[model samples]
Structure formats: C-alpha cells, structure tokens
Target chain A: MSRPALAVSALRPRTAPGWRTGLLDSLDAVGAVVLSPVELVGMAVVLLGRMAEFMLLAPFARDRFAFQRLIFARDLGDLLFGPALRVLAICVVLGIAVALVIEQFATGLLSQTGTANLVIVTSLQQIPPFVASGVLAARGALPLAVRLAEMVDRGQIDSMAIMGVDLVMLHAVPRALAVSLASVVHAVLAMVVFGVTTVLSLAGLGLVSTGTFLTALKLLPVYEKISLIGLQLLTASILVVAVALVEGIQGHGEERVDLARVSMVCILKAATVVLLVNLSFALSRMPDLPVLVWR
Target chain B: MRPAAPVDEAAANGLSVEVRGLVVRRGRRRVLDGVSLQLAAGAFLRITGPAGCGKSTLLQTLAGVLDADQGSIRLGGRPAATALAAGQVAAVFQRDSLLPELTVLENLLLPLIAGQHLSRRLAMLRAQVLLAQFGLVDIMHAWPARLSDALRRRALLARVMAVQPQLLLLDDILAGLDSAGRALIGRLLSPPDGRVASIIATSSRVDDFAHEAELLLTLPEGRISPSEPGQEGSGCDTRP
Candidate 1:
C-alpha cells in the first residue's frame, strides 16, 4: 500500500535482528576490504590507465571521458561495490579454509611438492570470477529484478505484452548482456590481480624473484587458464542472465508474484552458471592451449 | 441534439467486441465464469454490478491485461488476443493509472508514442487540442499527483481519447466527478454524432447516458443477467 517501508527503520540499531541490517553489515565489511591499500592502488592504477588512454588520444579524449562519466555513474555501484563485496565474502571463507589446510598439512605438503605456492595461487584464482559474477548479479540482475518488481506492482509488463513488445528482446536479452559484461570485467580484474600479486610477492620474498615468477606467468598454461576462464565466465553469465530475465518477466502473468520469487530465481541462475563455467574450465584443461585459444 | 460532422469522420466508425465463454480466475475465485457477450459497433454498453463482482475484471480481460482460463474474446471481428497482439486496443481504469511524476501532456504522449503512429509535433498538437477541449489547458504541465482527484481522472480520460482507440474500455471514469464535470466528460465520451464503441463499468446510471446508450447489461454478481433496452430517467441508482 504505502511502499511497504523498506527495512530502513529497523536498520537504525546495529543490533537489529533483521536480514536488512545483516546485509548492510556485510556490505560495510566488503567496503573495508575493497578500500584496503592493495585493492585501492589496483583500482586507482586501472582508473588512471583508462584516463591516460583517453588523454593520449587528443581527438577522442573528451568524448571518451563524457561516455565514461555516463557509464561510470550508471555502473559505479555494480562495478565497485558488487564485486568487492563478493571478493570480501570469498576471501573471508576461502582465506579461512586455506589457513586451516596450511595449519593441518604445514611443512609436509609444502616441502613435498615444492609447488605449495602454486597451489595457493591457483586457489586464489577463483576471486576474479566471483567478483565478476557478483558485478553481473548486482548490476545486471538487481535492475532486472527491480524492474520486474515494479512491473508486477504496476502491471506495466502486462501492458507491454498488450502492446506487442517482444518480451525477450525488449527487456531480457539486453539486460543479460549488460550484466554479463560486468562479470567479464570482474573476472579479468581477478586474473590481473593474481598475475601481478604472484609476481610482486614472489620477488619480495626473494624465493623466486620477479623474473622467475614473470617467466612462470608467461607459461602457456596460465594464458590458457585465464582465457578459458574468460570464455567460461562469458558463456555462463549470458545463460544465467537470460534465464533470470525470462523468469522475472514471466512472473508478471501470475495473479500475484513477489520479489522473493524473483530473487530465488536470480540466486539459482547464478549458481547454475557458476557451476557450468567451472565444469567448462575443467574440461578445457585437457585441450592444447593454442588450439583452444584459436578455436 | 446532434453535433456537426467532422470532415474525416474516421473517429465516428465503431468497432465490435465479442466474448465466448470467457472465464477468468483470480486464485480460487472464478471472477467471470463462462461469461459471453457481444457488443455491436457504434454502441455503448454500461456494465453495472455490486462491488467486488468482477465488473472490472471483465473489462480488463477485454483490454488484454487478464488472461482468460477457457474462452476467446474478439475485438473488431478479430480475436481479442490477436487484436492486442497486433497492437489495437486502449483502456482507462477506475484508479488513476497516470504516471504521477509526469505532466498531463507526458501522460497523454505515452500511448501515442507507444502506438508508434504520431510524431512528436503531431502528438503535441493533438495533446494541446485534447487538453483545451477537456478544459485541462490551464494545467497541461502539472503533474498528475498535483491535480485533484477529479482533474486527474479527466486528464487520464483525455489521454485515452488521444490514442483514438477503436474499443475504449473505461472503468468508472465518472466515479468521483461532480455533476457538472461528469456531464461534460460523458458528453465528450458520447458526442451525439461520434461513434466510438465502448464498455463503461460504473456504479451510477447517469441520465444523460440513457438516451445515447444502445444496450445496458446489468450484473448483480459476476454473471451478466440480461440485456435490456436503454431507458431514460433510470439513472443514478446510488444505493451502496
């Protein structure tokens, strides 16, 4: 009736035993992690490079910044907050598991393989996809979900059908593609971070130095892995987003449809896409790197 | 008192709508159970019923918003489903469905733009004329939220008219209007010479509409009782 007073009132107290408050707290924690020195530096460097690229091209610089400003305002939250929040959650959980495993196996596993560092790096590789998916889910999925909710409430989606707008193209496909791009960025960022951090840390420790890690990074397997991950993330994002958008639009036909239902569909879609990507990546591991890349 | 005819006279052509066993379900409740009716061209049918009696649902189903469980509805000799699929119907609801943030002109522009016929210039000219005709020229730029309930209703009606619909489905457009305002809108809706076929769901039976209407289909519950000849002075049955 009166906009159902979103959990803002109950969120006043820190101790409020509500999901809304909990979500806020989790978001705040994510903000802290993303703003940490290393991430901030990475983000700033990326932003500066983009600006420099704009500046160097005298003809296109102004137009580029104008476009960037429009896109940045539109995508800031999904780009910055979505993935950062996702990374925070993943880092916390995975960080705990990795710590536990290291404590348990300690000297034995590390000493035996002489590749324990590789294992750690490989495990951390998941961060990018996680961030990308979060961005996709947030940027793309949130708006679609919100639109569906509004459609259900106001009956506009029904009106759309009455007017003969193609339900899928008019709303769904663009929504999916828009969200998927965010996921792609997230995954690429994660890969870059992984590559750079491994090189820097290995050099700092003097265990393998910068050139050694850089050489390892150049190995065919690493490129193959990153590329394959990109392909997989793209594929998965498109699929999940398509499904979620379709479902959200279809929900309007019902006598009554709720946001909870749309959200469940979103979660299910994200999970299915992630699993498919993981499976694809595992399968791609056996293929020859060059062949896979070209094909 | 017949008005002078327009040169085009296209707006005066009427369209017929037919429903065959139209059944609608809102959860367990079957709002319109095996409902069947036929509205001829150049005619007005006033649907009257008690509150919560599926009067609005029936109109909505015709408007293509609600899906019928079992049956078919046709508009202008084609399936209502096909007609809507082909983009050929417009409606005005009991509740003010105007976009509150937008001005009266913007609200009217939505249907025209959506229908993809009139250009911006043509739409502006038509909107201005409609506003002036409806006496809404004073507040054409005012947001719907700022207008009074009656004014908002009038603005929405004006917008509905702007689309030049063949089948105009109105849901209680005259519900909250004062006598003078209601008479004016009813007159505009039913210009003696103009022939826009319509189905208006209303609680009150206005005296002015009595002469113009061809049929009166009364509904006590969800079912249409019987179509009787239009009678004068049998208006404003205000009993709740």
Candidate 2:
C-alpha cells in the first residue's frame, strides 16, 4: 500500500505577524542601526584600554615581557619595513601630482608666499597622513586582519587560549602598538618626501624657487609638525588598527569565502573610519561662522 | 622517549573533570543537548560518534573554547576556565592548531614561554626534548605548512604536550592518520610513565583508540547512548 504524502509547510510551525509584532520588529531594526556604532566604539575603547594596560604592566613583569617584546619587535619591523618601498613610490607620485596641480591652479592667481602657504597646507599638513593611512591600511592593517581572521577561523586563537596565552597581550597589543608607531613614521616620511618632491617639481616647472619653499617651511612651527604626527597617530593608526583587530577577532567560519567577505568588510569599515576621523578633525579646525546679533 | 616535564607546578598533577547537564546550541540546531560526563584524574575517556555528531563541539566546550548555553564544568575541583588559565588544560583541535607564522620549534616554545612564563633557555630545552620525543626533531625548524599531514599532527600534539597539561583534550587527533601514525599517537597518549594525568579524545570510529581508553561512550546527535557491553568502564558513568 502507498503511504499518503504530507505537506512540508504543515510540519513547520508558523507565526503570523500582528501590528505589534511589526512595530516591535521595526523598533528592533532601528535599535540595531542606532546601537551598532555605539557598540563598535565601546569595543574599540575596551581594546585600547587593555592594550594600554598591557603596555604599562608588561615592563614590571619581566618574564612575560620578553615574549611580548619579541612579538612587538617582529610586528613593528613588519609594519615599518615591509612596505617601505611601496610607500616611497606612492609618495613620490603623490608629490609630483600635488605639485603639478598646485602649480596649474596657483600660477598667476597667487604670489610665491601664497603658493608656499598652499603647499604647506595641502602637502605638509593634509595629504601625507591620508596617503600613509591608505598604504598602511592596504599593506599593514589588511594583512594583519587577514592573518588574525585566519587564525580565528582555523582555531589557532583557541589553541593559543588553551595554552594560556593572553590573547590581548600576544596579538592585539603588539599589532596596535606597531601600527600606531609605524603610522607616525610613515606619515613623517611621506611628508618629507612629498615636500621635497613638490619643491623640486615646482622648481623644475619654474612656478616657485627652492628658497621660497624653504622659507615657507621655516615659517611653520615645530608644534604644527608634532600635531600633524599626533593626528595621524590618532586616526590612521590607532583607530584603523582597532577596527581591523575587532573585525578580525570576530571572524567566523573557515571557508575562503568567509575570509574574503570579512576582509572586504574590514577594509571598507577602516576606510570609512579614517574618512570620518579626518572630517571631524577638519571641522574642528574650521573657523566659526559669523552669527547675527539679535536685539 | 618521554616528552618534557611540566613547566608549571600546578600542571604536573591531573585534572578531574566533572561536566553536568551541558547544553550548547549552534544557530537553530542543538549541537550538544544536556550532555553529562565525568572523568577522574589520571583516567582516559574516549568518545566515539558519527560525523557532525557534536564530538568536536563537546571537546571544545570542555576545553573552554566554546561556552555552553547551560551547564557547569569543573576541573580539578576548580572551574574549567581557571584550570585552563593555570595551564592545567591543553587541547589539540580537529584542525591544525599550530601558528602558521611560527616554526615547529617556535610552536612548541610558545606555550612554555608565554603561558608558563618559562625562561627562554628552559623553554627551548623543553621544546627540543618534545620535538625529539615526537621524532619531529629534523623538522623542528620547518614551518607548519611545509610539514606532511602526519608530521603536522604530530607537531600539534607535541606542542600541546610541551605544557604537560593536567587534562588533555584531543578532538579527532586520529582522524587523517594511517595505521602507523595512529599507533604512534596512541602510544603517546598512553605512555608508560603516565605523565599525562587525564585525557578526553574523540574519534569517528570506536576502534580508532587503543585499549588505553578506560571508558568508551557513543555520542549520537549530541546525547550519550549506552555503551556497548565491553566498552563500559567504572571510570566514566555513561548514564545520560
């Protein structure tokens, strides 16, 4: 005798949506959208706090400090030197491009002092950090993220945990510290290279003389350079690394597709963070608009 | 040859594991459903199950890698996380767990140096001894990716063994091995001196383990079934 067939939908339990359910669902979606950034910020703060603790406490604990130092040195070397040539090539090209643009726009419209001011504002102040961050994000943060995500996916992180390794001290602290220090160094290096190339390109183009550029640079105070480096340290290095590390640690699954998806997300988030941070900094520097006095 | 001595004093002794009503869920599926098991110090328990039967999940939960939705796990009269933090627990996962960036010797040295806070010289000496015992001395300097499958598995086991953990969790350590490879690992699992205190290993087939396993429990779909008559032992209460 043939058995009677049963409908697949009958086997599954179903719940009908009411007005309240739809309202609640909408609220949940809205809440997620609103709270996600807050949650991300909280994670970044906690990660940074733990890293600071490790850095502060590690030196006194001499026995564990050696391994931490080894990891730190390895990561620092990789970050600083791994993409040095690429950074140099990019900076050279950036310098030439900036110089060409400035010369084209500022030729007759501005004086030598104005051209120097423009170059100082754009080349020395603004562009270097962005370039350094972009390079480091692509070369340093992205690779670190991939490695960390792969480690998480492959159970290597769990293995480390099983062996009693402090995940923060071993992975996050060293990488974050390295990325921060390397970002500052790269930004400074880019600035110097960019400044030199811009001056030379303009000199070649006869837009401005080397002496005028030197005078302009001399007029800029040392604190400004320090502030520029500090700004890069804050935004490109610390923030970007924090986002990458958090995304990496939250990696799921061992599939190549999962890894690629995580990496793409990391890069996009990091780029967005960098842009937002720079925008905030720029806004903070802007002069207040004039307000009408009311009687 | 025997592996190295325990770097931490607490790790020298065995950990008695007591798991009660462990429940773990992955997405919509209950990977581990109210599983309960007990293992005494210096004893061996082998869990056998079919593919996707929550063997790895159980091992991971016990090792404190994955938290249970509902359950209590105590090791050596302390919590599982505490025991793990004290270097009293070591796990070799089903996948290759060695750090790809480090070499075989570095892999061995990491837990000893980082976890146990052993001196570099002492850690190096212990790592060398473990490498020698596993017959991995020649490939100690080789990267994990460069090693053959059997050798990689051996290295992973050696690295975990380097800590001389009180409780060892082996998740399908015998999965991809030939008979000889299995025999080698089996011998390591049941050393003559019994330096390792307690072990919980999972395998797809019951025969994968040697006679060293005192109790064999079959986990089908996350619940422990009655053991086969001869597979039962006093060490484990298979009363789920």
Candidate 3:
C-alpha cells in the first residue's frame, strides 16, 4: 500500500526549528555551568544523587524506566541539561550546606568520609529531595504552567478560565502537584534507608563506642525523625505547589515556540525554593537573632 | 395538540451552534474580541483570513481545544464545550496533531478513548468504516510516520469524522494539499448527504464548493468580510 508515502509526507514538515534550537540552547547552557570547579562539583553531587535515587533505588517506582527509542540522548541532553544543571547546582549547594549543619550537630559524622564522603552523604540527602521537587515541579506544576503559559502565549488558557474549567483543578494544582508529592514521598523513604545505614556504619567501625551508639539510637526519638520527614515532605510539596501556582499562572509563551522560556521558569522555581530553604536554615543559626519557637 | 404526531421535520435540524460574546486573549493581545457567530444544521461555511488573524484560534475555541475568554458557546442548545468534549464535535487542526506512533485506525479512536464512552472493539469497527469510506482502508494498520502527506491529511480528517460530531471545525485543513487532493478532502468533510454542520478555514485562491456553502467570510488582519456564494464547481457539497 501507499503507507510509506503517507509516512514520508507526515515527516515532510521537518521537525520544527524550535525543537532543535531548544536542544542546542540547553546543551550550551549546561556546557557553561559545568566548566567551573565549584559548579562541576555541585553538578556531580546533585546528578549522582539523582542517579542513585532515580536509577539505583528506582525512586517513583520507576523500575521499568527506559527512555523511548525516539527520545534520543541528544534530545534528552538538550531538553534536560539546562533544567537539570540548575537542579544540580541547587542540589550541590544544599547538600554541602546540610552536611555542614549535620557535622556541627553530630561529631565525626564525616571525619572518615572526607569532603567526598560529605558530598556523598549530603548529596544523598539533598539531591533526591531536590530532584524529587524538580520532577514534581516539572511534571505536576509545569504541564499546567506550560499549558497556561501556552494559553497566555496563545490566549487559550484565559479563554479557558473565562469558560470556567476550574482553573485550579482543571489546570493548576492537580496532576503535576500530585505527581511531585508522590516523588518526594519516594525520596523520603530513601532518606530513611540512608540514615539507618549511616548510623549502623558508625557503630560497626567503633567510631562511637557500642554503648554510646546504642544510647544514641535509643535516644533518637521517633517523633523527631517523623517531624524531619514531615518537614522534607512539606518543603517538597510547597516548592512544587508554589512552582505550579506561580509559573502556571504567569509565564506567557507560545506552547510550540517558547520551550526555552518554559525551561527557564522551571529552573527558576526549583532554584528559588532551594534558596529559600537554605536561607531559612542559615538565618535560624545567627547568634544575634531572636529564637523562633519552631527552632 | 394535533394527535401527538412524531414530527419528522423536528428531528432534522442537523447541528446548531450559537456563540455569543466570545473573547480570546493571548498575553496582552486579544485575538477574538466579543466575536459571535452561528451555524444552522447541515450548513457549510468557509472562514478565510490572513495569517495570525485568529481564524485558527476561533476554530480551536469552537472545538473545545482552546477555551474562549468571556463567552457562551452552545451546540444544540447545550454547552458546546461539554458536548464537543463528549464526542459531539470533531476538529482538524492546522498542524498534523495526530499521534506519530499510532496506526491510522488507532488514531481515529483516540476521541472515543478520551470520552471513555466507547469500547476499544466498537471504536475499531467504526474506525474501519471511516477508513474504508475515506479510501484509507489499505493504510488502516500503517503508522502515521509512513503515510503520504495527502494520506496523512485524509487520515486526520477521517479520525475526527469518526467521532460522528454534530459540529465539525476544519482549521486550515488544506494548507499543504494540492487542488485535486483538496477536492477529495473537501468532499469527505461535507458529504452531500452528511447532516453535520461544518465551518472550514482556508486561504485558497479557488472558490471550489460555493454552491454548498451558505456563507463565505474572509478575514484580513482579524476582520470578517463576507463573500457571495457562487455557482456549483468541480466539488460536490455532498447532498443526496
């Protein structure tokens, strides 16, 4: 039959320049960030954590994940690099900062594990959660944001709102947010596994005497761990929700044309949340500040 | 009061569309500003426009793919948004928006799947009939990536038509097709015996089916300028 002829015609339009340009721009942006030492280290930590969570631990129940054949690495690199790089930066900085926080709280936690070890643990703790947040933001928040931005770009979302599709449910905070929270939940579980392993490793190495180790473990109130998990979950949810709400309602861009604009907004949202959390923790420790009740 | 007779005339209104105060905005630009239009059952109308003048926007709004800002659009006196979403309206877009991976038959049944109203088996049966009618029976199992440009256009048209919409919106559906191909597609879209009300958007030089068309409006930079309906030409408006 003339099926082959029809298929060739279907591809006749030549995949749009926008898709190619988007991929190229993403690659260029990533190349710029990865050239710096601090940025590269940060990138490594964040990516490693994400890889471990996404590929190793198989977070989000993505055990069967395989990139579609049509979804080439070049395309993925182009699509994900710019966005993923920013995710890496936030993850790395947050990881280092958290490691510093934990080092002060519990002695010798990273004495054996050098900077690399600290990077590993901190990246482990921070990367998955951060990556989880990004995924949620991208999937749960961005689609609607993308749709709204596209609408704003095309004037369709506004019309949709005018038509009453329940802008929040039909557009903003449903699928993307739900998917993000689901991802964060997965990261939280991984954190628990990591925490147990770290605690056990310290005990096994006689780093802390068995008596002290057992006592520390015993004194580790379930309430505190639960609260910590709750905080991470809350933070991830807020970031995803905030990203969806802010970006979805704002960015005005043509759906088919402004992919770069969309990716930028995604990165901005991820970075803003990362900065907010880091700043809050940093401010909490200042010697001159009035103590907040929560702290 | 007159013997409670089943009035055959009452059932043949075909598809009626009433749109009031439809406004569409993209960013700061208002694409459609308080625009209103109507279509009687089985009426054929052509909407022509210069590029970027909201012709496609208007068609998409009618198809429920794009929501209109501040408007009331009804099909058969019910909200067209709901009805179209429920498979009462079929749409062919400017782009080949068909899923690239699915076969011809599979693509046609996407709407039924979207509505969650038709089973896979029944949808396939309907798809086969549409494909056969559109002369795409041989390519029923072929992927969209393998089809010719003409076949791709016909396949998309068939997919939308398979939904059995009371209202059909054709947005720049003939952009790439040759004259002969366009004629074939036009006949398939508004078969003479077909009862569906249709609105087609084009930028063609030829007035091919003026006899079948009730209204022909050209839009230059977003303003509708009406045209007179001409005599019958090579194309059939598809009346019985």
Candidate 4:
C-alpha cells in the first residue's frame, strides 16, 4: 500500500466511530428541522405540477369538462376500494388498541382527570389520521407504483411518449388526486370507524356513559377537524406523487428485483413523510387542540 | 400566432435527415461516436450493424429520444428536436409500444385524433379503411396485448403510417416476422410512388434487403460507412 493509505488504514483501526462523523450527523439533523418548511412547500409544488400535467394532456384531456368529472368520479371510486379501505382497517385497529388501554386499566383515574380527554382527542384527531396516512402510503400507493414500474419495465411508458401522450398527466395526475382525495375520505371514515369502536368498548364495561361521551366530544370546534383533514390530505397527495416518481416512473427503467427494492424504499419514504408532517401539524395545534373526540 | 392549417397539408411536405458527428453515451460508454449521414426525401437507407453496436441509439437520436452528447442532427434544415416537435418523425422501437387497455383500432386512432378533428363516425370509417388496407381489418377490435409479436409490430407500423410522418424510424422491429411479413413491410415502407424518408436498423443479412433498399449503410465500430447493395465478396462479418 502507498504511505498515505497505510497511515489512514492504521488510523481507522484505532479510531472509535470518529467525532467528525457524529458532529456532521448532528448538524444534518439541525438542518432538517430548520429547512423543513421549505422542503414541504417544494414537495407540494412538485405534486401540484404533476397533477396539472395529468389534468391538461392525458387521454382524459380530450374529453369534455363534464366527462372529466365522470372520470374523476371513477378515480374516486377506485381509491375508496383500494387505499381507503386498507387504511380504514389500520385506523380501526389503532382505535381499539388505544380504547382498550383506557378502559381496562386506567378506568377511574383516566375518567376523572384530563388524561382521559387527551387520550380521546388524540385518538380521533391525531392517531387515526396519522396511521391512515401510513397505511395508504404502503397499501394504497403500492399497486400504482408496481403498475407504473411494470409499464416502465415493458417499454409501455416510452410507447405512450412516442405517441405524444403526456405520461405525467396521464398516469401521475390521476393517481395523485385519487390518493389525496381518498386520504381525506379515509380520514373521515377512519375517525367514524374508530369513534364507534372505542365508544362501544368503553360503554360495554360501563366505564363511560353515552351522554357524557357525546358532550365531551362537542368541546372541539369545526376548524380543528377541518385543519386535521386538510393536513392529512396534503401529506397524502405529496407522498403519493413522490412514491410514483420514485417507484413507478424510475422503476420502469429497472429490473424486477431492483423495482421491488425501489418500491419498498418508496413505501418507507412515504410513511416517513406522513409521520413527520402529521407530527408537525399536531404540534402546531397542540395548545388549542380539540377536546374528547371519540364521542 | 398563425392560424392552424390542415394536417395533411403540412404532412405532404417531405423532411430530409442529416446527422454530423453524433455521439450518444449511456452511463459512461459511448454507444454512437462521430456518426454522420445524409438522407434525401423519398429515400430508404438501411443500417446494418452487430448487436449492441448502437443501432438503436442512432435511430433514437434521429427520432429525438436520447439527446446527443456531442455533435448535432438536423432534420430538413432544422434541429432534430424541432422536427420532432413539429410532428415530422415517428419511431417503431424493438419493444412493443401498444397500450394494452385499448383495442387495436382505438390505439391506432390516437395519433390520427391528436392534431386533427374528426367526428366519431368519420374516425371509425377512416380507421376501418386504413386497417383494411394494412390487412388488419379482422383484428381491429382485438386487444393489442393478445396479438402475436409479428402482428403487434404490424399494428405499430400501421400507426406510423396513419400519422403519415415525414421521417420514419424502424429499430429492429421486424425481427420476429416471417418472409411474407417482411416483404409486406418492405413494400409498405417503399411503395411504388411514395416519397417518405426512412432509416431502418436491422441485423438481417445484407442480401435480405438488397432488392428493396436504395442506399446501404453499415455501422461498424461506432461509425457508419457506406457499402454496395448486395455486394457478395467484400466480406465484413456483421452477425451480432
């Protein structure tokens, strides 16, 4: 080995996870926090641009405006069965788990104090929506990513391009909108599913009365619900488009194994984006947050 | 901006293609290097090369798919990109380009419907006529994915013809065809009185297209050079 290489190799054997690496990693974490707003907004712009492309030029573009709505309705129907139902199951399961904790062990103390109110509100407002986002990222977005990737693999995307079909407008836009709208719909459905399950479980053991539950729930205003739904919708749309670009579009140019890896990475990244954004939105509304939400 | 003209009015104006020192790089390797050629309107230039010899790259560059790393390609006194944007070029790659969801007739109607306005009745009538002429009338309603490889290639060729593009590019799309199929394509490409410009890349031996092609160009070692049509003895082993 050369003299410099020999010296660096000798140094590496002695050093314990260098101080420079840790310091750089810490700096990166700080940068992420400071730059998150810019990052999120940039992601939003990209999502909007892709959706706009789909709206303007795909095969759907040739139709009349009324016909476009009919197509959008079809897209909505597809999402309800695909991503929304998958996410709904996740939300319901989460609600049951949280409700069980409250009912079985902390019945008296939780019912008497503010913790009961906090748990109830968090269950409906934050937890279900967050978990729903994660579920859609994995379940709802998976098939679209796989289909687009396969198209890319088989030269179908290039074929459309050759025919002057705007692929982004054709493929990306429809999926993005479907996922976003489905996310919002799923959030509402999840909250309903979660609320009903939690209330029934709490009532079954005589832990809480039905009247008390409904009154506590009315403490949160309409704006809180609107804000949470809006945030979830935005996050879902952004992650859906991001996954499509990563796993769907780029994956088309890759082999099956590589595409699978890309797809797994896409799902992980989408879930991460959803969790981080949901946490940020929750923190922003924490002080003025809604009261007992499972009524 | 000027008002739009009739689609066929502009399509009848032929386009010539010229490439000078064109170089295309995939990752780090240079697929095409300093390749230069000229083709007049109403001419057929057959490109013969071994596999992985950048035959597809040259055709893709000419069709404005992959951008050139160095040098330039001009189509009818304008840049290749400009000609492509003006709807002067059409390419049939080795892979199947049909949309699986659509019937063959619906997919064929895509290009024809893009720039021109047609009522559904008129569109169907015209599509019937074109498919009939291409000997594909029976399979008009069939799904593209269900067709055989040779038949799929013919459907793609039929789409290219429907567009009536000035510059046509075929990149080994004829590989799976039988002799009759090959002759049908050859005749379609070079009809008795047609003035369309075309550049085809094939691994078929020199003798296969000797009677049909007017100019023969061989891409050996990254650069394209001219060779005599059906020349028997000049022997360059080009089986890739």
Model 1 regions more than 4 Å off: A1-117, A120-125, A194-211, A225-227, A250-254, A286-295, B1-13, B18-30, B33-46, B64-74, B77-82, B92-163, B171-218, B226-240
Interface RMSD of each: 14.0, 17.4, 15.6, 19.1
- For model 3, residues A77-145, the per-residue Cα lDDT tens digits are 333333444444554455445544545654564343233233333334444655555554554455545
The DockQ values of the predictions, listed in order, are: 0.07, 0.29, 0.07, 0.12
**What does candidate 1's lDDT look like per residue over B59-159, in tens digits?**
77787666678888777788775555545566665543565535788667655543433566677788888898888999988877788977887887787
Q: Return the top candidate by lDDT.
A: 2
Q: Number of the top candidate by TM-score? A: 2
**What is chain B's TM-score across the candidates, in the order shown?**
0.81, 0.85, 0.79, 0.81
Residues B11-76, candidate 4: write the lDDT tens digits.
Answer: 444566667667766545566666666565545667677776777667767766566778888887
lDDT score for candidate 4 against the true structure: 0.62
User: What lDDT tens digits, residue by residue, belong to model 4 across residues A76-128?
Assistant: 68777766566667766776787788887788787764455456755577766
Please give the TM-score that candidate 2 achieves against the real structure.
Answer: 0.83
* Model 2: residue B106 alpha-carbon error in angstroms: 2.2
- Give the per-residue Cα lDDT of candidate 3 at A262: 65
**Per-residue lDDT for B84 in model 1?**
59
Ordered from best to worst lDDT, the candidate numbers read: 2, 4, 1, 3
The native-contact fraction of candidate 3 is 0.00
Better of 1 and 4 by DockQ: 4
lDDT of 3 by residue, B109-139 (tens): 6544423336656767888888888999888
lDDT of 2 by residue, B51-146 (tens): 887888788888776767787889988888677667677887777467777788888888787777888889988988888889998998898888
